[model samples]
Target: MEYILAKYNYWIYILLMMIGLYAMIAKNNLVKKVIGMSIFQTAIIVFYVSIGAKRGASIPIIAHGHGHDVIATAVSAAEYANPLPHVLMLTAIVVSVGTLGVALAVCLAIYRRYNSLEEDEILEQLR
Candidate 1:
Protein backbone atom coordinates (compact mmCIF):
# COMPACT_ATOMS: atom_id res chain seq x y z
CA MET A 1 0.00 0.00 0.00
CA GLU A 2 2.79 2.41 0.87
CA TYR A 3 4.65 1.69 -2.34
CA ILE A 4 1.49 2.09 -4.38
CA LEU A 5 0.72 5.45 -2.79
CA ALA A 6 4.23 6.71 -3.42
CA LYS A 7 4.11 5.67 -7.07
CA TYR A 8 0.65 7.09 -7.55
CA ASN A 9 1.92 10.61 -7.07
CA TYR A 10 4.34 10.20 -9.95
CA TRP A 11 1.61 8.74 -12.17
CA ILE A 12 -0.61 11.73 -11.48
CA TYR A 13 2.22 14.09 -12.36
CA ILE A 14 2.80 12.25 -15.61
CA LEU A 15 -0.88 12.42 -16.48
CA LEU A 16 -0.99 16.16 -15.84
CA MET A 17 2.09 16.71 -17.99
CA MET A 18 0.65 14.75 -20.89
CA ILE A 19 -2.64 16.58 -20.69
CA GLY A 20 -0.83 19.91 -20.71
CA LEU A 21 1.25 18.90 -23.70
CA TYR A 22 -1.79 17.74 -25.60
CA ALA A 23 -3.60 20.99 -24.88
CA MET A 24 -0.63 23.01 -26.06
CA ILE A 25 -0.40 21.08 -29.32
CA ALA A 26 -4.10 20.70 -30.04
CA LYS A 27 -5.38 24.20 -29.30
CA ASN A 28 -5.53 26.93 -31.95
CA ASN A 29 -5.93 30.14 -29.97
CA LEU A 30 -2.95 32.05 -28.53
CA VAL A 31 -4.68 32.41 -25.17
CA LYS A 32 -5.32 28.66 -25.05
CA LYS A 33 -1.67 28.00 -25.74
CA VAL A 34 -0.75 30.25 -22.85
CA ILE A 35 -3.19 28.42 -20.64
CA GLY A 36 -1.62 25.12 -21.66
CA MET A 37 1.84 26.46 -20.89
CA SER A 38 0.64 27.43 -17.44
CA ILE A 39 -0.85 23.98 -17.01
CA PHE A 40 2.45 22.39 -18.02
CA GLN A 41 4.28 24.59 -15.53
CA THR A 42 1.85 23.65 -12.76
CA ALA A 43 2.31 19.95 -13.52
CA ILE A 44 6.04 20.34 -13.01
CA ILE A 45 5.40 22.05 -9.68
CA VAL A 46 3.14 19.18 -8.66
CA PHE A 47 5.90 16.71 -9.55
CA TYR A 48 8.46 18.60 -7.43
CA VAL A 49 6.16 18.95 -4.43
CA SER A 50 5.18 15.30 -4.61
CA ILE A 51 8.82 14.26 -4.53
CA GLY A 52 9.36 16.45 -1.47
CA ALA A 53 6.74 14.56 0.52
CA LYS A 54 7.75 11.57 2.62
CA ARG A 55 5.58 8.84 4.02
CA GLY A 56 5.69 10.24 7.56
CA ALA A 57 7.98 13.23 7.52
CA SER A 58 6.94 16.71 8.60
CA ILE A 59 7.86 19.85 6.69
CA PRO A 60 11.58 20.67 6.44
CA ILE A 61 11.32 23.75 8.62
CA ILE A 62 12.34 23.08 12.24
CA ALA A 63 10.09 24.18 15.06
CA HIS A 64 11.24 25.56 18.45
CA GLY A 65 9.60 22.86 20.54
CA HIS A 66 11.68 19.82 21.65
CA GLY A 67 14.87 21.07 20.08
CA HIS A 68 13.80 19.70 16.66
CA ASP A 69 10.65 18.04 15.41
CA VAL A 70 10.35 14.32 16.19
CA ILE A 71 9.82 13.48 12.51
CA ALA A 72 12.99 15.32 11.56
CA THR A 73 15.00 13.32 14.03
CA ALA A 74 13.92 10.03 12.46
CA VAL A 75 15.02 10.60 8.88
CA SER A 76 18.46 9.96 7.42
CA ALA A 77 19.94 12.20 4.70
CA ALA A 78 19.02 9.80 1.87
CA GLU A 79 15.38 9.72 2.95
CA TYR A 80 15.07 13.47 3.39
CA ALA A 81 13.80 15.66 0.56
CA ASN A 82 16.50 17.80 -1.00
CA PRO A 83 16.18 21.57 -0.54
CA LEU A 84 17.68 22.27 -3.97
CA PRO A 85 14.62 20.98 -5.80
CA HIS A 86 12.44 23.36 -3.83
CA VAL A 87 14.72 26.30 -4.57
CA LEU A 88 14.80 25.44 -8.26
CA MET A 89 11.03 25.18 -8.24
CA LEU A 90 10.80 28.71 -6.84
CA THR A 91 12.79 29.94 -9.82
CA ALA A 92 10.70 27.87 -12.23
CA ILE A 93 7.52 29.44 -10.80
CA VAL A 94 8.86 32.96 -11.33
CA VAL A 95 9.92 32.17 -14.88
CA SER A 96 6.56 30.63 -15.66
CA VAL A 97 4.77 33.76 -14.43
CA GLY A 98 7.00 36.00 -16.52
CA THR A 99 6.45 33.87 -19.59
CA LEU A 100 2.71 33.90 -19.05
CA GLY A 101 2.77 37.70 -18.79
CA VAL A 102 4.73 38.04 -22.02
CA ALA A 103 2.45 35.59 -23.79
CA LEU A 104 -0.62 37.57 -22.75
CA ALA A 105 0.99 40.84 -23.82
CA VAL A 106 1.81 39.45 -27.25
CA CYS A 107 -1.68 38.00 -27.52
CA LEU A 108 -3.21 41.39 -26.78
CA ALA A 109 -1.09 42.98 -29.48
CA ILE A 110 -2.16 40.31 -31.94
CA TYR A 111 -5.79 40.86 -31.04
CA ARG A 112 -5.45 44.60 -31.50
CA ARG A 113 -4.04 44.12 -34.97
CA TYR A 114 -6.32 41.27 -36.14
CA ASN A 115 -9.50 41.76 -34.08
CA SER A 116 -9.73 37.99 -33.69
CA LEU A 117 -8.02 35.54 -31.35
CA GLU A 118 -8.17 32.48 -33.57
CA GLU A 119 -4.85 31.27 -34.96
CA ASP A 120 -6.06 30.87 -38.57
CA GLU A 121 -7.70 34.29 -38.54
CA ILE A 122 -4.48 35.89 -37.25
CA LEU A 123 -2.49 34.22 -40.01
CA GLU A 124 -4.94 35.44 -42.63
CA GLN A 125 -4.76 38.95 -41.25
CA LEU A 126 -0.98 38.84 -41.32
CA ARG A 127 -0.98 37.77 -44.97
Candidate 2:
Protein backbone atom coordinates (compact mmCIF):
# COMPACT_ATOMS: atom_id res chain seq x y z
CA MET A 1 0.00 0.00 0.00
CA GLU A 2 2.79 2.43 0.76
CA TYR A 3 4.58 1.67 -2.48
CA ILE A 4 1.31 2.03 -4.35
CA LEU A 5 0.69 5.50 -2.89
CA ALA A 6 4.19 6.58 -3.77
CA LYS A 7 3.97 5.23 -7.30
CA TYR A 8 0.46 6.55 -7.83
CA ASN A 9 1.40 10.11 -7.15
CA TYR A 10 4.07 10.00 -9.80
CA TRP A 11 1.68 8.43 -12.28
CA ILE A 12 -0.92 11.06 -11.59
CA TYR A 13 1.53 13.82 -12.31
CA ILE A 14 2.58 12.15 -15.55
CA LEU A 15 -1.02 11.69 -16.64
CA LEU A 16 -1.80 15.34 -15.85
CA MET A 17 1.17 16.49 -17.89
CA MET A 18 0.10 14.45 -20.89
CA ILE A 19 -3.48 15.59 -20.66
CA GLY A 20 -2.48 19.23 -20.39
CA LEU A 21 -0.09 18.94 -23.30
CA TYR A 22 -2.71 17.29 -25.45
CA ALA A 23 -5.21 19.99 -24.63
CA MET A 24 -2.72 22.69 -25.47
CA ILE A 25 -1.89 21.16 -28.82
CA ALA A 26 -5.27 19.79 -29.88
CA LYS A 27 -7.72 22.47 -28.74
CA ASN A 28 -9.07 25.12 -31.07
CA ASN A 29 -9.74 28.05 -28.74
CA LEU A 30 -7.11 30.51 -27.55
CA VAL A 31 -8.57 30.63 -24.06
CA LYS A 32 -8.59 26.85 -23.94
CA LYS A 33 -4.95 26.87 -24.96
CA VAL A 34 -4.11 29.21 -22.10
CA ILE A 35 -5.99 26.97 -19.69
CA GLY A 36 -4.11 23.99 -21.00
CA MET A 37 -0.80 25.76 -20.59
CA SER A 38 -1.62 26.59 -17.01
CA ILE A 39 -2.57 22.96 -16.40
CA PHE A 40 0.72 21.82 -17.84
CA GLN A 41 2.67 24.29 -15.75
CA THR A 42 0.88 23.23 -12.59
CA ALA A 43 1.55 19.57 -13.29
CA ILE A 44 5.25 20.35 -13.53
CA ILE A 45 5.14 22.14 -10.19
CA VAL A 46 3.40 19.14 -8.64
CA PHE A 47 6.08 16.89 -10.05
CA TYR A 48 8.80 19.08 -8.57
CA VAL A 49 7.16 19.26 -5.16
CA SER A 50 6.57 15.52 -5.11
CA ILE A 51 10.17 14.89 -5.99
CA GLY A 52 11.28 17.02 -3.05
CA ALA A 53 8.81 15.56 -0.57
CA LYS A 54 9.72 12.62 1.63
CA ARG A 55 7.10 10.73 3.66
CA GLY A 56 8.34 11.74 7.13
CA ALA A 57 10.74 14.61 6.67
CA SER A 58 10.09 18.06 8.10
CA ILE A 59 10.75 21.18 6.06
CA PRO A 60 14.32 22.35 6.26
CA ILE A 61 14.83 25.59 8.16
CA ILE A 62 15.99 26.84 11.49
CA ALA A 63 13.18 27.56 13.94
CA HIS A 64 12.15 31.20 14.42
CA GLY A 65 14.99 33.43 15.67
CA HIS A 66 17.37 30.55 15.15
CA GLY A 67 20.43 31.31 13.06
CA HIS A 68 20.92 29.79 9.60
CA ASP A 69 23.38 27.25 10.92
CA VAL A 70 21.43 26.43 14.06
CA ILE A 71 19.07 23.83 12.61
CA ALA A 72 21.96 22.13 10.93
CA THR A 73 23.66 21.83 14.26
CA ALA A 74 20.63 20.82 16.32
CA VAL A 75 18.64 18.50 14.09
CA SER A 76 19.70 15.04 13.15
CA ALA A 77 20.55 14.78 9.44
CA ALA A 78 17.70 12.31 8.89
CA GLU A 79 14.94 14.70 10.00
CA TYR A 80 15.20 17.59 7.59
CA ALA A 81 13.87 17.72 4.04
CA ASN A 82 16.20 18.76 1.24
CA PRO A 83 16.09 22.50 0.63
CA LEU A 84 17.60 22.70 -2.84
CA PRO A 85 14.65 21.32 -4.75
CA HIS A 86 12.24 23.57 -2.87
CA VAL A 87 14.25 26.64 -3.82
CA LEU A 88 14.37 25.53 -7.45
CA MET A 89 10.61 24.95 -7.32
CA LEU A 90 10.07 28.52 -6.10
CA THR A 91 11.95 29.87 -9.09
CA ALA A 92 10.07 27.59 -11.45
CA ILE A 93 6.75 28.75 -10.02
CA VAL A 94 7.59 32.39 -10.69
CA VAL A 95 8.62 31.59 -14.22
CA SER A 96 5.44 29.59 -14.83
CA VAL A 97 3.31 32.51 -13.63
CA GLY A 98 5.15 34.87 -15.93
CA THR A 99 4.67 32.51 -18.83
CA LEU A 100 0.98 32.06 -18.08
CA GLY A 101 0.45 35.82 -17.91
CA VAL A 102 2.16 36.36 -21.23
CA ALA A 103 0.14 33.54 -22.81
CA LEU A 104 -3.14 34.94 -21.54
CA ALA A 105 -2.23 38.41 -22.77
CA VAL A 106 -1.48 37.04 -26.19
CA CYS A 107 -4.75 35.17 -26.19
CA LEU A 108 -6.56 38.37 -25.29
CA ALA A 109 -4.88 40.18 -28.15
CA ILE A 110 -6.00 37.47 -30.52
CA TYR A 111 -9.55 37.74 -29.27
CA ARG A 112 -9.47 41.51 -29.78
CA ARG A 113 -8.12 41.29 -33.30
CA TYR A 114 -10.44 38.57 -34.55
CA ASN A 115 -13.36 38.99 -32.17
CA SER A 116 -13.22 35.24 -31.67
CA LEU A 117 -11.16 32.90 -29.55
CA GLU A 118 -11.09 29.86 -31.80
CA GLU A 119 -7.76 29.07 -33.39
CA ASP A 120 -9.25 27.83 -36.63
CA GLU A 121 -11.46 30.89 -36.92
CA ILE A 122 -8.48 33.18 -36.35
CA LEU A 123 -6.47 31.41 -38.98
CA GLU A 124 -9.38 31.65 -41.39
CA GLN A 125 -9.73 35.38 -40.68
CA LEU A 126 -6.03 35.85 -41.29
CA ARG A 127 -6.16 34.06 -44.61
Q: Largest TM-score belongs to which candidate?
A: 2
What global local distance difference test value does model 2 have? 0.82
Ten-residue region with minimum lDDT total, candidate 1: 62-71
* lDDT of residue 60 for candidate 1: 61
* True-structure RMSD, every candidate: 4.2, 2.5
Q: lDDT per model, in order?
A: 0.81, 0.82
Say which candidate scores most in lDDT: 2
Off by over 4 Å in 1: 1-5, 65-81
TM-score of each predicted structure versus truth = 0.79, 0.84
**Superposition error at 120 for model 1 (Å):** 1.1
Question: lDDT tens digits, residues 1-127, model 1?
Answer: 8987859978888888988898888899888888988988999998998767666655565444364346465545554556666888989999998999999999999888889889988888778
Q: Candidate 1: TM-score?
A: 0.79
lDDT measured at residue 65 in model 1 versus the true structure, 0 to 100: 36
| lDDT (tens digit, per residue) of candidate 2 on 1-127 | 8887758868898899999999999999887888888889888888888888776788786446365655455556567777777899899889988998888888888878899999888889989
